[model samples]
Target: MATTPSSAMRSLDRAFDVLGVLEDTRQPLRLSEVARRAELHVATAQRILNVLIERGYAAKEETGYVAGPAAVATAHAFLVNNRLSQVALPVLQELAATTSLTASLYVRVGHFRVLIARVQGRNPLRYQLPIGEKLPLYLGAGKALAAWLPDAELHSLIEQSAPFTRVSGEHVTAEDLAADLDQVRKAGYALSLSERAVNVTAVSAPIRHAEDVLGALSIAGPSSELTETDHTRLIGEVCRAADAIAARCP
Candidate 1:
C-alpha cells in the first residue's frame, strides 16, 4: 500500500518525539520509560527505537537506551553553525571571567527559553545543565527575555505560568510576575534569587536588535557569593555584556 503524506508526517513526528525524549535525559532510559515519556504505546516505541538504533541516532545499553554519537554530532553541528552561539561565546566568556559566575545566553522557544551557550565561572554549579535545556520564560532570568514581548503575549505567558513555587517556598502569582516584569523593563535588567534553583541567583539583561529583543544574557552564581558582590556592578556587567553580544549579532 502506498503511504499517504499525512501518515509519513506522523511517522516523522513520532521519530522526533522519541529522539527528543532520549535527548532530554542525562541517563539511559528503559524502553517502557521512553515510551511513557513519548506518549507512545510500547510496541510502537519499540519499533521506533529499533529504527533509531539502526540509524545510530540512539544506542541500546545494558540499562536501556541513550542518545548516540549521531545525535551528539547533530547537536555539535548546530552549536558550530548557530549564529547566536557564535556571536555570544566571547561575550559570555568575558562576563563569566569578570564576574566569577556562570554566564549563559538564552533564546525564546515557545513560552520557554533554551540555553544555547554558557561559560563556567571559577566555581561552577554542581548541577550543570546541558546547553539545550529549556526553562519557563516566566521564571528567574527568563523574565528579561519576556519583559519586552507584546503586552497581550506577556500577560498570557504570565497567566499560563503563574502560581509557581520558588525555592524559597513562596508561591508566585500572575500579579506578582506582572509587577516583576514591569520592574525589569524599567530597570533594563532582571534579578532573581533562588527562583529557579536552591541557592542560585541570577542577573539578566535583554539582548536587543534595533527595536526587537533577540534573547537574554545572564550571570548566575550561588546566592551567598553573588549577594556579597555589589549588585550594581553585577547588573552593569551583565547588561553591558548583553549589549556587546547584540552589537556583534546581525
Candidate 2:
C-alpha cells in the first residue's frame, strides 16, 4: 500500500526528531534512548536513524549515534547568515560603552535562546555571558525576545516549553510569563532582577523591522551598580540604540 502524504510527513518529522535528540546530547545516543526520547517505536526509530546515517546527517559510534559534521556545518551557516547578530553587534558594543554594563544580543533557536554576541563593559564587576551559550527562553534577555514573538509563534513556544520553572531564584509560571509578555508589549521593553543569575539585573528592549520584532538587545550589570536610577537610564539608552539599529536595517 502507498503511504499517504500525512504519513510520509510524519515519518520525515520522526527522522528530524531523532537528529534533534542526538544534537542535544552532544554525544552518541543509544538507539533505545533515541526511540524513548522521540516517542517512537524502536523499529521505526531504527529505520529513521538508518536514513539519517546514510545521508551523513548522523553517524554510528561505538556507544550509539551522533550527529555528523554536516549538522555542524549547517549550524555554522545559520550563525553566519543570522541578520540580527550582524546588524546588532556594533550597537551592542556602543551600548556597553555608554552604560558601563555588558550588552548582549539574543535570538530564539528551537526551545532556547542563544547568545550570539556580547560586549563587556569597562567596570570590573560587569556581567558577562559567553557567546553561543544557550539560555532558557523564559529568563533574562531570552524571555524578553520570547515575549515579543508573534501570537502564533509565541503560543507554540510556550506550549513547547510549558511547565515553567525557576532560574537563578526567579519563580516563573506560564501565567506569569504571559503577564510579563503583556507588560513588555505595553512598555516596549523588559526587565529582570536576578532572574538568570544571582546579584545581576538586566534591561532589554525589542529590535524591530518595520512593525515586527525580530530579537532583543540587553544591558546587564551587578544589582549594586544597576540601581533604580541606573535602570531607568539604561532602559532609555537601550531603547534608543535599538531604534537606531532598526532604522539602519534595509
TM-score of each: 0.84, 0.83
Per-residue lDDT of 139-202 in model 2, one digit per residue for the tens? Answer: 7787667776778978887767656555565556667778877888789888888777778888
Mind giving the per-residue lDDT tens digits that candidate 1 earns over 75-114?
7898899898899999989888988889999999778898
What clash pairs does model 2 have?
A: none
Instruction: Rate residue 68 of model 1 by lDDT.
Output: 82
Report RMSD (Å) for each prediction in the order shown. Answer: 2.8, 3.0
Candidate 2 stretches with Cα past 4 Å from truth are 1-7, 26-28, 54-56, 59-62, 123-131, 152-163, 168-170
